[model samples]
Target: MQRRFLVGLIGANIGKSLSPALHEDAFAAAGAQGYYHLMDLQVLQGRATLESLLVAVRTAGFAGVNVTHPVKEAVLPLLDEVSPEAREIGAVNTVVIGRDGRTAGHNTDRTGFRRAFEEVLGGKAAARQQVLLLGAGGAGRAVACALMDLGVQVLHVFDTDAARAQTFAADLQGRFGADRIRAAADLAGAAWQAAGIVNATPIGMLGYPGMAIAPELIDTRHWVADVVYTPLETQLIATARRKGCRVMTGGGMCVHQAAEAFRLFTGLEPDVARMHRLFNEACARRDAKLAAAG
Candidate 1:
């Protein structure tokens, strides 16, 4: 039997978010019909506006919602309760509102990171492997945790805000150990000569341009992944490709995370390969829109 369609929500530097397309594809793949909306609280007034939107979604019958940056942590107190990992990560990226009208929050970023990373690396990105990470905010925390779980030997974290980067490093060290974490003293000078490098920052996105790290630092020996997929053809990914590094874009994370959330909301396993196809189609559509606008 065909399932009823539902609604979903996402926010961040969402001016270029592909979530609507991704979910639209999911609904179609699952033989469920539904719509996803791109909600920008920045355009609205504040939390009040966001709360009102959430209420409206409930009234209108949204299946579930996906929360992104800025609101991932903020939406915690507003939620009925959250998953243990979401609580531990101090962030939530997916929310499912049940038939009882109760909301449950989950952090799929970490799990998504691991899934995507393993899919590319084909094994645990263990401690013996050096991993360089850009950005110390939510995505950094999620990836760092995933690396630690994989027994990664060391993590080099860098951010323009040195203090923020140091603080996140300290937290990781405190939880994991000093042996597995360190601050990037030199982004150049082979400090990033690691098995993998990741751009956890919002750089290289729509309004944002430029590589998260120096292009000179990228080489064929390192595996590169960026959490940005708006343009999808981000400078980081492009440079990595030129350097012959295996590249993973935020698109993979988007699909895997949503699939997990879909299972939570529907209690049925998602058709992941089909989800990927839908996501790619939606991305193509977005590119067409941008081209037309230009």
Candidate 2:
């Protein structure tokens, strides 16, 4: 009998996510049957919450689910166990369901972001320059750790919520040191002081259609990276590119994280090369569809 697994992704504004296609192809290549469901918060808004969806998926015998966006940090308390790394980062991107129905959460975002940064930027985040990070939320936490691990000398964290940014910086200070990690009070001021900018927030994605930082603030010398993949070339990425700045799309992190999540869900090694190939194809298709719609 062929092995079968049911998994899901829970997030908002994810109607365009290609994770379902990627996972299905992976399962077929490995001779297993898989069903990947998308539980878009945009669709389930009033009907369900992250807490309820976690319970629902678990009760329905789901293998696991990938948590994203606003809920990555919110899902932590709902899990029976969270990996030490995730506990430290205060976010969970992947969860593994045990045979006993116990759920354990882990973070693949940190690994995924790190690998992507090394590949795309050749580890430029480690250039020993002061870096500015926007959005000190779930994804931001993972990116912050990855940046530090890559030898980033100093990191300034900023968010629309001033207190949240300050709190996140305070939490990371114990591990990475207060001198290296700081809460940025001024957006333009932080950008002026940093060498690179990382948007860990959802601002550049589809429904959230605006660059976190202004265009004029991004100079040609500043390298920029955004964690929004839907429109591969987000406004931030495009702005950085036009200024001749090195840039990274969220696609790398998306595919790499999906690969890690697949391994955790099915205990199967993922063909990362295949994922990259499919991801590019999917993006091309998405672009074409958008063009046609217009």
Candidate 3:
């Protein structure tokens, strides 16, 4: 008999998320009965709350859930337990609910970012000594640690919310040491100083459509990476590539991270390559539909 698994993602402005297609494809290939649900906050309104959704998923026999955006950090205090790594990163992107209804939080973003960074841009890009990280939100928190582990001697984190950027940078500074990380209050100045850049913000994604760093700020010498894969290539990535900078799209990170999340949810190893192919195919199809509609 095929094993059954139920999993989902929780986030706002996520109707365009490729996660359902990616995971369902993986499950089918693995010969397992699976349902990948989307608990989008945009569509939910008052129909449900984050706290209520967790309880519902646990009671409804869900294997786990992936949290994103505004909720990743918010979900931390709510989980029954959190991995030390997730705790240290100060965010939780993945949560596994036990059969006994106890929920445990984990973070695959760190390893996922590192693996994807190495895969797409190579280790040479990560050791740039200094990198500008846009957004100090949930994803940024994970990517920040990844950059540090990958040998980034200095990381300048920036967020539209100055306080968030400062607080997050301070937290990371304590762990990685004050000399390595700090909030980049001057976006323009930091862009000039950093050798490479990583965009962990949602700004360049489908719904949020704009470059986090202005086009003028991107230089030919800098390398760039983004965490938004829905459009496949974000504006920042496209701009950087045009400027002759080495670039990486969020697709690789999304695939590698989802591969880890799939394993945690189903105890099955997902074919990362297969997921990558599916992701591209799905994005192409989605773009085609949008183009046709217009």
Candidate 4:
């Protein structure tokens, strides 16, 4: 008999996530019986806590779960062990349930973003340039670490929550150096000096629709990247493109990260090109649906 794998994604406002389609299709192609589910917090209506959800899924024979958005940091304490990289980033986006019943947390976000950036933008120029990064949450931390790894000379960090941004900057400064990372008090000022800008917040996602930075701040001199994949072309990306700035969408990160998560869940190398094709197909379907509704 062939083995079967079950996995899920846990997050709020994720009804439109493409993770399930991506993983399930990969599993089918790999000849495994796989079922990927979405455990939307908003849909759960508090019926189960994160702890309870983890327990329920594991008990029900799930192989693992992907953590997202608001729960990425919150899920850390629930894991039996965390990968060193995840510990360093203070976030967990992937959790695997071992056969021995121990759950280990690992973050694939950094690797995902790094791979996407390198693939889309030749790393040399971007690596040498200073970057203005928006947000300091779980995704932000991952992107910041990836940017530093890519050789960004300086990272100007900003978040709506000033204290959160300061704390995240302090943490990164301690790890990298005070010279490499600093919290930004002025968005326009930081963008004026940066060669690139990245948005790692949920601001431009489907449920949350808005640009993280002022459109006027973006110019032809800067490159822009966003991590919100639901609306592949966010207002930020659109604005930056109109200004002739190079842009990277959240779709690449979404596909790359899902590829890593697929490997962790099934221990099989997924065809990344196929995964990208599937992701693009899913996005097209989403866009078509929205267009029809409109």
TM-score of each: 0.88, 0.97, 0.97, 0.98
| Residues 47-72, model 4: lDDT tens digits | 97788999988898888999998899
Model 1, position 172: C-alpha lDDT score: 78
CA lDDT scores, all candidates in order: 0.78, 0.91, 0.91, 0.92
Measured by TM-score, how close is model 2 to the native structure? Answer: 0.97
Q: What number of clashing residue pairs does each candidate have, in the order they appear?
A: 5, 0, 0, 0
- Give the clashing residue pairs of candidate 4, or none: none
lDDT of 1 by residue, 74-191 (tens): 7788888888888777778888887777888888888888887777665554447888889888777887888877777888998889888888888778788898888886777424
Estimate the lDDT of model 1.
0.78
Segments of candidate 4 deviating more than 4 angstroms: none
Which is superior by TM-score, 1 or 2?
2
Clashing pairs in 3: none
Task: Give the per-residue lDDT digits (tens) of candidate 2, residues 1-294.
Answer: 999999989998889999998898888878899999999998999999998888889899999999888799888888999999999899999989887789999999999999999999888556688999999999999999999988998899999999999899999999989899999998889899998999998997877888999999999988899889888989899999999999999999998999999999999988899889999999999968976884
Candidate 1: stretches off by over 4 Å: 45-48, 58-60, 124-127, 288-294
- lDDT of model 3 at position 105: 96
- Give stretches of model 2 more than 4 Å off: none
lDDT of 3 at 107: 96
What RMSD does model 2 have?
Answer: 1.2
Per-residue CA lDDT of candidate 3, range 70-159, in tens?
799999999999999999999999999999999999999998999999998888777847899999898999999999889998899999
